[model samples]
Target chain A: MREMIKMVVVLTVLSSFSGGLLAAIRNNTKERIEYQQLKFVKGPAIRSILEGCSNDPIVDRFKIKDGDVEHSFFVGVFDGKPSTVALESFGKGFGGNIGVMVGVNVKEDTIVGVGVTTHSETPGVGSRAKTEPDFTAQFQGLPLKKEFKVKADGGQVDALSGATVTSRGVSAALTDAAGIYERVKPQLMEKLKTFAN
Target chain B: MAKTLTQEFVKGLWDEIPPFRLVLGLCPTLAVTKTVENGIGMGLATTFVLVFSNILVSALRKIIPSKVRIACFIIVIATFVTVVELLMQAFTYPLFLKLGIFIPLIVVNCIVLGRAEAFASKNSVLASTADGLGIGVGFTLALGALGGVREILGNGTFLGKTVFGPAFQPFTFMVEAPGAFVCLGLMLCLMNLVGKK
Candidate 1:
């Protein structure tokens, strides 16, 4: 009887209080979290890519068309131009998952910007390289026709002094983003045309 | 058993060390300990959760039922993790972002869960609280050791500043995943050697 009573007490304390608190907060804040994610993480990328146009939320899996990637992103339209797109790329790095926010200008066939959405790089080397302007600046203003390579390989970009592997991983992610944007560029342009009308 | 609460708290310093001796929570210990600051942050957050949850769980262990006890425990842990996440976001947003999923992932950190199962679930509330404090501090210290070595060697710095002179080039490997294993492995071996004494 004592054991049974103890178990009853344990379960009630665990469930009734903590569980109730989390459930209440989750229910109360669900909409706010959803709104913030939309406004902060995605919103800036959308505006940057399309330059002041709004977009339909991109889904990984849809009722009609499934979004293929795990992280969801949207495409934006502006004045009959599909100027920008936001997508996440996961690359295996020296450590683990390196998720990056890649924004591209489809019209120019160039990258708009790349930001570290999430990464597990080594603190002083690989992680630092991610934000180093010299490393990141290499992506900016280069059109689709330009070769993406470290100057060591006869390309324009200079690799970080010691973080080549991480830089390569990030650059590979950039290349992948460019490739993906190429595929959907046409549909994105069409969506913008409709919006302009 | 006759020791005061201060002794109970201080015992986590050597005996019952969470990471080295108990070997309880190795995931985040391995995953994020590339720097001492990162480890410290993770450790403190985890300790807060462990102390609070242990106290609450012991207090309520008499009232809970048997069949759904595991689910109930998870709910309690998850709530505290969420609370820490919110508090970090409001105050330490940068560090909050740096911690990333590891914050929520603390819900599964075996140290907190293990104590809940081994001590808090069975012992008096005061004893459980003491145990929680001991284990939590021990884990923090372990993380700090790992983080310290990696930060110093990999970047020639400690806690975001250059501690070593400019001439000391960093060993890149020390900050990588392999470094986490090698450093911890070496530390473990050193610890075992000391234990034999």
Candidate 2:
């Protein structure tokens, strides 16, 4: 009992110390992290995908309402032109959940960028969607209007070397995003004016 | 005091190496090590957490109760993980995205918990700190070697730079899961062959 009491006291002290250090680091770095998130993932995405892009507000699922559910999105704009738009595609990959954000230029129906925000592919196999030719290269110049798919399914894109399931998952997500873009393409273009403001 | 601290520090590298010697952190060791860049990134993140947690636990060794020690260790480890996650996001955004859940998963890395319970709990602060550094370095070496072999064969690249001639046909299997085991097994054989046990 005496030893147990001593052990409890030790653990409490450790917890407090670790908690204090953690709070200190988080407080110090929070601003830098916010700045980076704005500068890199969201900002570069806009410049690459949108024309005459300057600044854009990234809207998560909160503001945008869906039919019965709200979805997440971000847009880039300059003057009045909707230069860039990003749509999230949540889909199942070979191993599990996959989330990809595809940035598109509605004017030319071309993809300005692709980023895998989340993935649970089978490590080296399916996860290569972020790096390899068969996945990302396919997005570089394809029309947002074209049916997104793997070459195996008679589309113009090649699937990953051994990750057909994941390849298919990402393809489907892109397809869904493309279709959604087609529907809201005009509204998104008009709404680009509000991105920076 | 110095001799006692020496034992605490030396054990992490020699007697209980996290990956190759102890076989504790096999997940990321097997998963992200296709390139030296990813492997080094993961190892360093692990080290950062290990060092911080080990020190915190050692500093508070006098008060933690045995029954709840494991739970407390995990919370402390998790907090350090959050710290590493934040720092990586700030300085290495690309690498941070690449690491994904494994960053949070460091809380489960046997090395952290093992050290907290095994060494830090009984050891002095200085000794635990040494252990943290030694184990961290050894783990980094193990991961670096694994990445070296994988990238050389599978991608024909070294540390994200090409190290092979154009004529070389990169072997695909060398970058996959099975290849991780093969490389790791051979590495263990080598580590054992030369290690001063």
Q: Highest lDDT: give the candidate number.
A: 2
Which structure among the candidates has the greatest DockQ? 2
RMSD of 1: 9.0
Count of clashing pairs, candidate 2: 14
The residue-level lDDT of candidate 1 at B78 comes to 80
User: Cα lDDT of all candidates, in order?
Assistant: 0.71, 0.77
Off by over 4 Å in 2: A1-48, A52-197, B1-16
Model 1 lDDT vs. the true structure? Answer: 0.71
The positional error of residue B16 in candidate 1, measured at the CA in angstroms, is 1.0
- Model 2 residue A136 CA deviation (Å) reads 14
The digit string of per-residue lDDT tens for model 1 on A1-197 reads: 87777667766655577667866777666655555555555554444444565445343111111257434445555554445656766666678867666766666777766665567888989886555656665666676442356666666667787877676667666666665556655655555454343
Query: iRMS for all predictions?
Result: 4.7, 2.2
lDDT by residue for model 2 over B57-76, one digit each (tens)? 88867766667778888888
Question: Which residue window of length 10 is worst by lDDT in model 2 chain B?
Answer: B1-10
